[model samples]
Target: MMKKNRLERNSNSYQKQSNVKEVWRRLRKNKGAMVGLVMLVIMAAVLIAAPLFVSYSSAVGQDFSLVLAKPSKEHIFGNDGYGRDIFARIIYGGRTSIGIALLATAASCIVGTILGAMAGYFGRTVDNVIMRSLDIFMSVPDILFTMAVVYALGASFFNLIVALTLAYFTNYVRLVRSEVLTLSEQDYVEASTAGGATSMRIILSHIIPNSIGVIIVNTTMNVAKIILYESTLSFLGLGMPSPQPEWGQMLSESREFMRNAPHLMIFPALAIVITACSINLVGDGLRDSLDPHLKS
Candidate 1:
């Protein structure tokens, strides 16, 4: 019996590994997804290694002589009005922008997942209460609501993250709740419940795991949305404060010099566009990979 159980466990593990490999194979077949993955990896590496090559002080320091200097061998991206290295600032700014997006996405996912699971598993009063709350949040225009929160809370990194998370988390709650509602009706979930498992246990052990595919895809896509929202807030002066290397803040600072110093705006805008596109492509690939119908 023990030997047979061990063999069964090994077989199940092998099957799980094979399933993962198949998903990777399908994801790799997507050209856009591959390109996006490469781009994101490159950007992440650059951001991680930036501080090693460029000092933080120099990236944010002022040099009156180098102010508004055009792109050259010394300053590949040219100097900003404050004479800080635009290239360095971009590298550093990527850290802040990407960090905020990732952190906010994670926060939303956690909060949304628990609430969605509870609502879906419990139904009735719990479902109505949670759904109604989410509806109220969804009723507000995201940008306007985010702006109001930021303005009210005052602009800071934590507040900005909170604002963005509050504005964006509704999607995850709704998505996860829908997924859970469907998953709860599956045979396995019914079996678990019949086996004397509590609602929490069934929701956590069976329903959530089964519903993870859509949750993953949605979470991946939401990263890009969070980045854009962060940028908008920073551009509107409701994001990170000055002296911090944030891409949106950089763009906001360069608006006055756009005509003569177009590079100031060009680089940051390109970064945002490329990052968002890459993330979206990745999300698409994940959606395809996780779709049972598309699996080979």
Candidate 2:
């Protein structure tokens, strides 16, 4: 009974400690970042709730009479080339673009983290080959590399995710490998090894947990980059096709109408800009809070 009580007490203490260390605590201290976080959450919520609130069948549905209409009670962001509701299109289209970005970033992080952990924990030839291969991948501009990969694979949502993972995973691998290398050399890691812990156990239990701070920060920043990449792909005609209501596709389609219906370009551009900026602001806050060196 006494041992059971002691164990319960210890478990409660651990939970309390973890709660205290949550990212929000540090994030709250940075008012600007907190505001950005809130804005991002609101944007995501709005996009997710779009289908529930809006009644347009297709994002590109046209009403010739409403073409080039300005913002009003009926059309919040005005009408676009095909006379579709710019506001509705943006809100719904965000779901696709943002979804793609998140999935691609997650794929990159997982693959990169695994490769990096293996290379760093088991150095020598393994490290050399992995790092050298990553170097080759990273040598080219990511956008160009992604384009080449997508061009070869042909552009679909799945292919886009693959291209992004291929293009961006090298960065994650490099960062994670560097962090693992640094952390593995620490005395605690050595101590764990000396105490008969297996290489895998030490890597999972000690190295990975300690290196997660870096990973979290990098992942947050990568989310914004992923969004930008998706937009670029759409702009280049390699992403979602027309009438799909994608932001990049919208920007490309609206370019010609810059002189007449500038609202078409303006609204989509603002969506991409504001969303990316909000993500970056939150990421910056996380980076500063997670890394003691960056904390001010």
Q: Against the hidden reference, what TM-scores do the models get?
A: 0.96, 0.91
Put down candidate 1 lDDT per residue, 37-124, tens digits, no spaces: 9999999888888878888887788998998999999889999998999999998998999999999899988899888888888899
Runs with alpha carbons beyond 4 Å of true place in candidate 1: 1-12
- Single out the weakest 10-residue window by summed lDDT for candidate 2: 15-24
Q: What is each predicted model's overall lDDT from 0 to 1?
A: 0.90, 0.86
Off by over 4 Å in 2: 1-23, 56-58, 293-296
Best by lDDT: 1
Backbone clashes in candidate 1 total: 0
lDDT of 2 by residue, 1-296 (tens): 99998997899789757744765677789887988889998997898778788865646688889888888998889988778898988987798889889999999999999899989989999999999998899899999999998899998889989999999898778888899988988998999899899988998888887788789889988989989989999999988767777889889989898998899899999999998889899888888777666444
The candidate maximizing TM-score is 1
